[model samples]
Target chain A: MSLLEVRDLNTFFRTKHGIVKAVNGVSYTVEAGKTLGIVGESGSGKTVSAMSILQLLDTNGFIESGSIKFDGRELTTLTRREMYEIRGNDISVIFQEPMTSLNPVFTVERQVSEPFMVHQGLSKREAALRVLDMLRDVRIPNPEVVTKQYPHQLSGGMRQRVMIAMALACRPRILIADEPSTALDVTIQAQILKLMNDLQEEKGTSIMFITHDLGVVCQMADDVAVMYCGQVVEMAPARTIFGKPQFSHPYTEGLLFSIPRLDTPSDVRLEAIPGAVPHPLKLPDGCKFAPRCKYATERCKVEEPELVEVQPGQGVRCFYPDLKERRKDG
Target chain B: MGKYVLKRLVYIVIVFFVISFLMYALYNLIPTDPARAQLEPMRQQLKPEEYIRMYKQLRKEMGLDDHLVIRYARWMGIIKGLKGKFDGLLQGNFGYSQTFKKPVVQQISEPMKNTIFINIFATIAALGITLPLGVYCAVHKGKKFDTTVQTMSILGYSLPIFIISLIFMYFFVVRWGIFPLMGSKTPNATYEPGSWEAFVDKVYHIALPVIVMTFASLGGMTRYVRSSMIEALGTDYIRTARAKGLREKVVIYSHAWRNALLPIITSILAWFLGIFGGSVIIENTFSLNGMGKLYWTGLNTLDFELVLAIQMFYTVVSLIGSLLIDLSYGIVDPRVRVNK
Candidate 1:
């Protein structure tokens, strides 16, 4: 069994206008010690689907239908109390903005060591020592002094390092990183990604890395799931997805084309996927990508495509999955 | 931190000087004379020449004849208190209260003590109830408990203390005769200050006023706490806390509450300092001999000296309260620490 398996997950939120289907029939798996990158634009349900695994949605949001099995244990069926035991123990999360993700009033030691004190049943002194070691593992400078300082006392990159330390302190089996390095600058972003990669290797931890950046996915993911408008339109191994994908959904093709690279000719314009992400409440009836897809057919506008495996370890959710023919039609 | 406090202390001195000077000048503008008001009852008995002589003598003795600046300087002891004897505010002379027929310091000391006692009790009661109530409301937000607490808070906030005090007096005092209606204690009771009887009597008399005081601010304080907590709970840090596997209780109290406490502390300090002023309507309605009632009587009888002293006392209290708040910010949140 995969370390974490989410099958046909559907999550919705209660809003005044109507229920918002935030995550619609999403399925994925993170194998032991492997990274699965869930890449999408904002509001594409990447974060929500991850949150559903932990049952940590806001009060207004509810999992309408889903089965999340973490190491053969059905997470959706677990009591809230049981789920809490798994959080920060079996699985942990690192958020986007490090500056705001830590309580400003608490010391770094308190924030980082609390999981140890709670789950490991360590005394305060023991937790403090563990926190220092965890900080050291994250390559923080002067771990002793950093542990005593508050969140605001540290720089942005340093704070994110602290967050990473806190999340990985328990040596969680699975780590969910929700746009972890998106808020960081280029240099800091590279360092943090490297740190997470090293940590994952050291502990043999599985990671569900969520981001909108294809570049980040290329660097971090073993497998990639491309989400568009609350649904994963394509799934394949990272090499297959990035290197001559056999059955690429039009949305996935557009995402790949949008990447600006140093090797691209100067005169050639970078292709941006056209149109905004459809609002969750007012999503189109058929294939969600059809509205923004250059090669969308009349049939594509009328009938939604179900995700199907066209090749081994690869899935595409479009009627016209061939990239060459679709581009020629446009 | 020490340097910040010392700097704040100097600022407090400057603020007090400006406030006291304005108060004294404003008092002089009132066109009322302590001597003439005192002599009004005996005006018909004295000849015109004798009245004139008494007025001049009283003015000179009271330093009313001196220039306002000179009088202020002497009062603060920058000019006076230089000899072997000291007769200024620096020497603890708050002047005399003509209305109470005693030294200003003596007249105010007991009332100040009573006011502080009543207010501190009320504040403790208010916060003790509201802090937990606010946290509960925030945690169970959108539930029945939160809705009920929010409704009660709105009602408490809107109803004036005077109205509430009157209702309490009518029901608990006039109708039921279960609680004392007025005064800090029974007028002629001889129980020692620390004795049980004296304490009970003081509690009995201050009960209605304290309840009124607590209710008056309870709504605002609870709302402040609730909103602050709610905001904190929505922050990314709070999500991080929950993601740490901390129970809901620990998340709310240990994580969310710490950040929410800063604003709550500010409001608490404001309320604590307000104790010296006393609740005017509540004091008057209950006929308690607290600072509010004394200030009311002093103002009505044109006792500027007593009014001036009370104003100065309030100014000093406010300055000290603000300074404490500034220093406490560093303790509560290291981000604002001046030394760093």
Candidate 2:
């Protein structure tokens, strides 16, 4: 059984204008000890879907309908208290902005030790000891001194490491790292990814790594799920998706081609996907990506396409489903 | 941090000196003769020639006969008191109260105590109501409870203290007659102040003023705290705290409250410093012998010595209070400490 399975997840945000369908009919799963990279642009509902598994959406947002099963148990049916118990003990999440994530008033030790103290019922001193161990595990130098310091005293990378230490201290079964390195420089990003990869390897932890950067996903994901406008358009094994890319979700193609390459001539302009994300409250009736897709046909404008499995473990939600077929026709 | 505090302390000393000099100069501008204001009591007893002679001697004794700069120097105890010893305000001699016929320090001492007592009660009351209510209002922002509290806070904030005082006096004292009309204690009550009866009467008499002061002050404080808490609750750290699986109560009180407290803490310090200045409208409306009333009477009578002394007292207290706030800011926010 998959460690985490989300099916037909629909999340909505109630605002003054109307209800915003932030995550509509999104579905994916992560197997034990494997990483599932949920890649999307900003407001693609990637983070919202991940947050729905933990029921962590803000007060205005909630799961409209979905079955989030973890370890063969239906998470949707669990009481709030039961969900709370699972949150830090079995499932942990690291948010995007490292600079703002850690409480400024608290010492690193206090923040790092909270999960252990809360879920494990460890005393303050016992938690402090484990905090040092976790800090060391995350490879923070001078764990003792670092523990006594506040979040402001640490650099951006160090603070992210502290966040990782806090999240991983309990060896949670699943780690939801939401754009963990988006705010860091390239070198620091590499270090953080390597640390997460190493930790995942050691603990066999299933990770739902959410990011807009396809490169980071390539480095860490075992399976990749491509999302756009609140729906997953393509999902396949990371190797198949990155190498063959048999299924052509034009949005994914845009994302893949837009990445800057050093070998490309400096004068050659990178192709960027056209148009902005449709406002969540006022999305188009048909395919959300048809307006931006160059290969869109007349049928793509009037009818929304459902995700169909074209091969084993591969799904695509489009009429012109594969790039190879389009290449052959051309 | 220590250096920052020491720097603030030096600033406070400089502020105190500047404030004292300015207060002296400003009181001198009131178009009333300092010697005549003091001698108004003996105006009928002395002949015109005798009064002129006495006024010259009194001016000489009070150092008023000297140049403005020389008078200020003497007032700082660089010259002399009546006994020719160093006894100006700088030497802890607050001069005398012409209205009360006593030393300024002696006359203000009791009133000052009453002011402190009323303010302490009011401060506690204001904070006690504002902290929890503000948090609740922020947590339930845009809800009915929040709207109701905000309306009340607005009413309290906008209305002047005397208006609230009169309203309370009418309903609680005149209409119901359960509490006293005015004064800090019952007239001719035999109970000593240390006795429970006197304490109860004091509480009863001061209740209206304290409530009025608290109401007058609560609106701004609660609004400040509520907005601050709303901002703090929206901070990313608060989300982290929630993501940690902490209970809602723990998330708010533990994680959000301390961060929200920075602004409220400064305002509270100002409130504490205000104990010495007291609320002139509230004290005068209630006929209480507090610092506020003393200050009003001193100014109205043009008792330059008393007015200047009271002004110096408020300035010094407020300066020291601000210095403490700046120092405490370093302790509460690590970012400030590091930058320093």
Candidate 3:
């Protein structure tokens, strides 16, 4: 069985104006010792889906319909008290901004060792030892001195590593890294990603990697799920998703074409996605991405497509799956 | 760090000297003659020359006959422990109060004790009520509890201290006949330290005024704390704490409250130093013989020496309070230090 399986998860926020369907019927699974990347634009509900899995949605938000099963146990049915036991011990998450994520008042050692203290009930001395070890594992030089220093005293990259150290300290079965390196510089980003990859290899940890950067996704993800407007538009093996990418969903094609490559000449104009992601409150009927899709049709405008299998291991939600074939047929 | 603290101390000393000098100069410049005021009711028939002679003698006796520069120098000298009849600047005898007909420092001592007693208790009571309620309102924001607290805080803020005092006096003291209406104690009260009867009497006398003072001050601070708590709760670190699977109490108190308290702590210190010492209205309303009342009396009587002395004491107290606040900032928030 998969370590973590999210089935038809729906999360919405109750607001003054109306209820916003932030995460609508999103489903995916992470097998043991593998990486599942959820790629999308800013409001594509990737982060919300990940947060919902841990039941960390904001106060106004509620999971309307979902089944988050971790290790054959239903997470959605668990109480907050029960979920607390599994959160740090079995499932860990690293947020986007490290500088803000780690409490400024606490020393790096205190934050890094908190998971061990919470989950394992490790003694202070043992927690300290493990914190230092994890810090070293994340390739932070001079773990002894860094442990004693405050968050503000360290640079952004160092702080990110400390966040990672804290997250991985309890040896969780699944690590959900939500845009972990997005706040970092290019060099630091590569370093952090490499560190995460190395750790996953060493621990055989399943990872739910959420990011908009397709390059990083290409580098790290074994499976890719493309989300658009609160729903999974496509899912496939990473190589097939990138290489053969069936040019069916115009949204996916736009996302692929928008990625700038070094091989492309500097003078040549790059392809850009035409419109912004639709506002969640005013999401269009039928296919949410229909308004932004180039291959949108009358049928697409009236009917939502199911996430049906197009190939053996690939799923595409589209009314006109063979857009190229349709053009040839025309 | 040592150098930074030393620099701050020197700044404090300079501020102290300047304040003292200003108080001294301003009091001397006032048209009212302290000697004439002292001798007013006693005078049956006195010649101008006699009055002038008596005034000059009194001024000379009080060391006020010296030049402005010289008097300031002497005051600074006393403060620095270089030359003064007293052991040091703050050691008992600064000068005698002509209006009160007693040693200025000695007269202030009792009133100061009363003021400290009332102010400290009231402030502690206000904080005890405000802190938890403020935090709860912030955490449960938009809930019925939060709405209720916000409404109460607004009502408390709107109601003036005098109005609140009158209401309490009416309900608790007059109608209920539960507590004393005014004064720090009943007539013919004698000191009996550690006695339960004495403690109960003192508490009864102090209750109404303390309640009035607490409600008057609680609104602003509670609002401040609530806003700070809200800001702390919205911070990324707080969300991270929740993600860490910590209980709500642990997340709110240990993570959020500590960070939120930096601003609240400083404001509380300021309120303690400023309001407690300057409670002239409350003291008069309650008929409490506190430092505020003493200052008010001294000012009304044009007792320059007594006024100047009280002013100087208040300035020093304020300076010390602020210095302690700055030092505590470093302790509470490790990120802040003497240097930055």
Best by DockQ: 1
User: Model 3 off-target regions past 4 Å?
Assistant: A265-267, A326-330, B1-8, B35-67, B76-92, B189-200, B337-340
Q: What 10-residue stretch in candidate 3 chain A is worst by lDDT?
A: A321-330
TM-score of chain A of each: 0.98, 0.97, 0.96
lDDT of 2 at A169: 79
Q: Report the lDDT tens digits of candidate 2 across residue range A56-139.
A: 788899889989999999998899889888887798989899999999999999998899989999999999999999999999
* lDDT (tens digit, per residue) of candidate 1 on B68-163: 898787777667632435577767888777787788998888777776677778888888999999988888889998898889989988887777
Instruction: State the lDDT of candidate 3 residue by residue for A3-77, as single tens digits.
Output: 889999999999999999999999898989999999999999999999998888888999999898999999998
Candidate number of the best TM-score: 1
Predicted model 3 interface RMSD: 0.9
Worst 10 residues of 1 chain A by lDDT: A321-330
Clashing pairs in 1: none
Second chain TM-score per prediction? Answer: 0.90, 0.90, 0.88
Per-prediction DockQ scores?
0.82, 0.64, 0.67
- Docking level of model 3: medium
Give the winner by TM-score: 1 or 3: 1
- The lDDT per prediction is 0.87, 0.87, 0.84
